[model samples]
Target: MLATMSTFELIDEASDLGQAVIKSNVYQHYLLAKKELQADPDAQERIRKFNQLKDQYDEVQRFGRYHPDYDKVSTDIRKIKREVDLTETVSVFKKAERDLEALLNEVSEIIARAVSESIKVPTGNPFFDNMSCSGGCSSGGGCGCS
Candidate 1:
């Protein structure tokens, strides 16, 4: 039988896991992609313009259709958003970000499952959303659904 770990030991193990994750390839790639994105002048300009347009859109959103420049601002925001999304640096950074998120989610799921299969883990995927607890505790599954 395995010996139970003290709270301090558990916390120490968690800290080690965190350090390992920071040094992982997925995280490194994400950092590199982010750095590249920040260094890209064109990409930065596009993102800046998109944010400026977004702020205008937010202000006009409060007035809805009553705002005079609402339509124009909305159109500009959409156009700028498309341009920003199409930028190669932005695209690479976004893909890296998603990959890093997936890695973290997988690690979280693993840790959760180690404790209990019924533990809910946010996977950022819609397909497995309802798979955490198929039956409630009242159904005799003891899945901690209370």
Candidate 2:
């Protein structure tokens, strides 16, 4: 059976994945900003520090499955929330949320298509003349099910 997860759990997993993406984006953005600003040392260093924190989170996210501290990620999120002022984190988190929402929409459409494709109808057969099949399989033999 496919593992069943609540919507919240799925959201959590996607958020974790998004965390990595957001960190990379911020780091790249920081690098660009640094170059454009002609090596503004303080700004570059600050972004670098922030990127490192995000990187640390990404590291936990990447290898959590292999460690006893697998649960540390969720705990770490709580810790960060408690320790850091969230004025900045929200926008980053919001961007991640939006990205995740878009991806989930695409995933949902794909799953819907897959489900739509899975329902197979039998071939044309005179047996189903009166079988009420929309496929025009009307015949007295009826469906093989008969």
Candidate 3:
């Protein structure tokens, strides 16, 4: 017979898992990269400028407003982003950031799948086509995840 775990036991286990994640190589690299990025003033300014430009572009698109300068600004932003990505410090930080995110997502999916199976809940369709995944869908229109 399998031994049942108490609520406290489960909580303790979760805490242990969290501590392990904090000690993982992915998490350590993320922290180091973040610190390096924060210490670099030039990189900080570039990121700020890029974010501001992206916000402006998004705002215009959100309102369905057309501006002649939109294309030019978009092109300039892309060029700036490319340059930023080419920088060693920022590039390393970005890769570390992505790695941390993927690790978190993998952990979340594992927990979700376990709970779903235990409760007899219907998980997502296994065979659904993912060709349209833009990795940015929100409201589930043609944005994918349809």
Winning candidate number (lDDT): 1
Instruction: Name model 1 segments beyond 4 Å from true.
Output: 1-5, 125-146
Best by TM-score: 1
Q: List the residue pairs that clash in candidate 3.
A: none
| Residue pairs with backbone atoms closer than 3 Å in model 2 (clashes) | 127-142, 128-137, 128-138, 128-139, 129-138, 129-139
Ranking of all candidate structures by their lDDT, best first: 1, 3, 2
Q: Candidate 2: lDDT of 134?
A: 32
1 or 2, greater by TM-score: 1
Residue-level lDDT for 50 in candidate 1: 90
Question: Residue 120 lDDT in model 2?
Answer: 37
lDDT of 2: 0.51
lDDT of each: 0.84, 0.51, 0.72
Error of 3 at 40 (Å): 1.4
| Weakest lDDT window of 10 consecutive positions for candidate 2 | 123-132
Error of 1 at 72 (Å): 1.0
Indicate whether candidate 2 or candidate 3 has the larger lDDT.
3
lDDT of 3 by residue, 83-115 (tens): 778777799998897787667756766776677
